[model samples]
Structure formats: structure tokens, C-alpha cells
Target: MAIRGALRELSVQLSLLNRQVGARLELKDVDLDCLDLINAHGPLTPSALARRTGLHPATMTGILDRLERGGWISRDRDPSDRRAVRISTRRDRNAELLGLFAGMNTSLEHICAGYEDADLELVADFLGRAAEAGRIAAESLTAE
Candidate 1:
């Protein structure tokens, strides 16, 4: 029960942090989410992105359009499938995006410094599994 409460708090805090960062960049939360997805696993086709995000195809189109208009992403022909288009974050904007989160990253590093190697590994492993569980839950909910 304690762990569940802590995890919920952490999730809410992280979402709020992302929302603040998104506001600074003149981006909506969903746009930031899609941008993060593209940055993490980019060069994905539009349909693939739509699936991963659980966004309707039409809504995904609007999000892609906004990102492209903001110079945050680019749409290009897929090399393997000339008929389809791929979406990717613009390389030039990487530095700018990183700069926005530099403070948070630095703070996290400081917090991590207090943990021993073994403890950090345990925490990392737990977090990885937790993230996977959350992803599966989201997928199930979307499917339903």
C-alpha cells in the first residue's frame, strides 16, 4: 500500500513536470508525449506511431501536423515503403529539448548519487518492470 501510494505520487509529479516543460516549449501535453515517443523510437511510420500512442489515426495526424509546424519533427518517405511516410524528431532540436530538461536531469543525478550501486540496480530493475506493467495496462485499457 505504501509503495502504491509512492508510485502514484511519483507518476503525478512526473506528469506535472512534463506538463510544465511542455508549456515552456509552447506544446500541449499530448504533443509532448508524441514527441517523446518519436524521440525514443523514431523514424516510425504514422500508422505505427498511432498504434503505439493509442491515438486515433485522425488525431495522430493533427498532432503530427503540429509537431511539424513547430519544427520539432519531420515527415519523410519511408525508405522501405515508398508509399508510406515516417516521422522523426529533427536532429537540430535535440539540444534545445535537452536544455529544457537539464535541470531535472541534474537533480536526478544528485538524488541518485546517494544510492549505492546494488541499491540503484535494484531500484532500476523495479522501475523497468513497473514501466512495462504500466505499458501493458495502458494497452489493455485501450484495446477494451
Candidate 2:
């Protein structure tokens, strides 16, 4: 019960934080989510992105369509797999987006400024383990 309550609180807080950040940057949640995933993972196929993002394939296609129209991302046929398509951030626009995020990044850095290396390491370990547990639980639920 305690853990569930804590998780609920964290979810609420994170959602609020995301909304605040998105509003500040004039971006929709889906756009930010897609950009964040692409920035973190380099290029990926639409299906691969759907799996990674927990979005439906058609929804992912729509997201990609919007992003491409906005000049934020580009898609091309994968060289190694002609049937598969790969998507990547558009270099010029990506740079512009990165520049826009620079201020937010600095603010985040300030928030972490007081953390020691050991404290940071512990936080990372805890979050990684928690994520793994969540993944396993999700897989089990899907299997059932």
C-alpha cells in the first residue's frame, strides 16, 4: 500500500512537471516524448519505436508523420533491411531543439548540483532496478 501510494505520488508529480516543462517550451507531451526517445536512442524503425514507446504502430506512424511535417525528424529505408524503415532526428532542427533545451538542462543540473557521486550512483541503481521490476511485471501481465 505504501509503495503504491508513493508510486502514485511520483506519477502525479512527474506528470505535473512534464506539463510545466512542455508548456514552457510550447510542445505537446507526445512530441516531447517522441523527441526524447529519438534523442536517447539515435535512429530506430517505426515498429521498434512503437515497442519501445508502448505506442500502437498506427499511432507511432501518426506521431512520425506530424514530426516529419514539422521538420523535426526524417525517415528512410534501412540499408540493411530494405523492407524496414528507419527514423532519425533531422540534423538542422535537432540542433535547434537542443539549443532550446539548453536552459532547461542547466536548470536540471542545478537541481542535481548538491548530490555527491555516491548519492547519484545510488539513485541511478535504484531507478534502474525499479525500471527492471516494472518491465518484468508488465511482461507477466501481458503474458497472462
Candidate 3:
């Protein structure tokens, strides 16, 4: 019960953080999410991005168009498949965007440092599982 409550609180905090980041960047939360995906495992194809984001193909196209126009990301032709295009953040601007969240990252690291190595490993494993659960939930939402 405590873990469920904590998870709910964490989800709210994360949503708020994303919204704040979106407002500060003058971008929508969904766009920020797409940027995050690209930042983590970028150069992904448009279809792959749509699948991961659970966005409709048409909607993803629009978001990609907006990001490209904002100079936050670019669309490139896939070398292996001329008909396919890849989505990726602008390497030059990625640092600038990431800087916005550096403080949060530092704080997380500091908190993690308070734990013993074994405890930290357990935390990591737990968080990984929790994140996987989130993906599963997102999949269910998309399926509907």
C-alpha cells in the first residue's frame, strides 16, 4: 500500500516536472516526450518512434514536423532504406536541452549516493521493473 502511494506520488511529480519543462521550453509535453525518446535512443525511424510513443502515425508526423521547424530535431533519410526517414535531436542543441534537467539529475545522483552499493543495486533493479510496468500500462492505454 505504501509502495503504491509512493508510486502515485512519484507519477504526479514526474507529470508536473514534464509540464514545467514544456512550459519553460515553449513546447508541448508530448513534444518534450518525443525529444526525450530521441535523446535516449535517437536516430530512430518515424514508425519506430510512433510505436514507442504510442502516437498515431499522423500525429507523430505532425510532432516531428513541429520539432524540425523548431530546430530541436531533424529528419534524415535512412541510409539502408532510402524510403525511410530517421528522427533525431539536433546534436548541437541536445546539450542545451539536457542542461535544463541537469539540476534534477544531480539531485537524483546525490540521493542515490546516500544508499549503500547493495541498496543502490536493489533500487536500480526495482526502478527498472517499475519503469517496465509503466511501459506495459502505456501499451494498455494505447490499445484502447
Candidate 4:
């Protein structure tokens, strides 16, 4: 119960932080999340993005358009499938994104600095599983 409570607090705080970051960059919360998705697992297709995000296809189109207009992402022809499009974060904006997150990154580093390597590994594994659990919960809700 203690860990779950702590995680709930962390989730809310992270959401707030992401909101602030999104506003600073002139992005909507959902758009910013989509951008993060692209940055993490992209060079992907619009359909794949929609699937991963659980957003409707039409909504994904609008989000992609917004990101492209903001110069946060680029839509290009897929090399392997010329008829399809691939989405990717713009290389030029990497520094800008990283700069926005620098403070948080630094703070995270400090927080982790005291932890032993084994402890960090355990924490990382826990976080990964937690994320997967969240994803599954979301998928179930979406399916409903």
C-alpha cells in the first residue's frame, strides 16, 4: 500500500510536470505525449502510433499534423514501403527538447546517485513492470 500510494503521487506529479513542459513548448498534453512516443519508439507509421497510443485514427492524424506544423516531427515516405508514411522526431529540435527536460534529468540523476547499481537495477525492473501493468489496464478500459 505504501509503494502504491507513492507511485500514485509520482504519477500525478509527473503528469503535472509534463503539462508544464508541454505548455512551455506550445504543445497540448496529448500532443506532447505523442511526441514522446515518437521520440522513444518511432520512425514508425501513423497507424502504429495510433495503435500504441490507443487514439482513434482521425485523432492521430490531427496530432501528427500539429507536431509537423510545430516542427517537432516530420512525416516522410517509408523507405521500405514507398506508399506508406513514417513519422519521426525532427533532428533539429532534439536539443530544444533535451534542454526543456535538462532540469528533471539532472534531478533524477541526483536522486539515483545514492542508489547502488543493484538497487537501481531493481528499481528499473519494477518501473518497467509497472508501466506494462498500466498499459494493460488502459487497453482493457479502451476495449470496454
Worst 10 residues of 1 by lDDT: 78-87
Which ranges of candidate 1 are over 4 A from the true structure?
A: none
What is candidate 3's CA lDDT for residue 3? 89
For all predicted structures, in order, the TM-scores are 0.96, 0.74, 0.93, 0.97
lDDT score of residue 118 within candidate 2: 92
Q: What number of backbone clashes does candidate 3 have, counting pairs of residues 3 or more apart or in separate chains? A: 0
Candidate 4 lDDT for residue 122? 100
Model 3 lDDT per residue over 36-69, tens place: 9998988899889999999999999899888899
Q: Where does model 3 exceed 4 Å of error?
A: none
Question: Which pairs, if any, clash in model 3?
Answer: none
Tens-place lDDT per residue, model 1, 3-119, is 899999999998998999899999999999999999999888888999998889999999999999999999999888789999999989989888989998999999999999999
Error of 1 at 39 (Å): 0.7
Per-residue lDDT of model 4, residues 1-144, tens digit only = 899999999999989999999999999999999999999999989999998889999999999999999999999999888999999999899898889889999999999999999999999999999999999998888788
| CA lDDT for candidate 2 | 0.78
Candidates sorted by lDDT, best first: 4, 1, 3, 2
Can you tell me which runs of candidate 4 are displaced by over 4 Å? none
lDDT (CA) per prediction: 0.93, 0.78, 0.90, 0.93
For model 1 the local lDDT of residue 67 reads 95
Candidate 2 lDDT tens digits, 83-137: 9889998877666666756876788799778899899988789778987888688
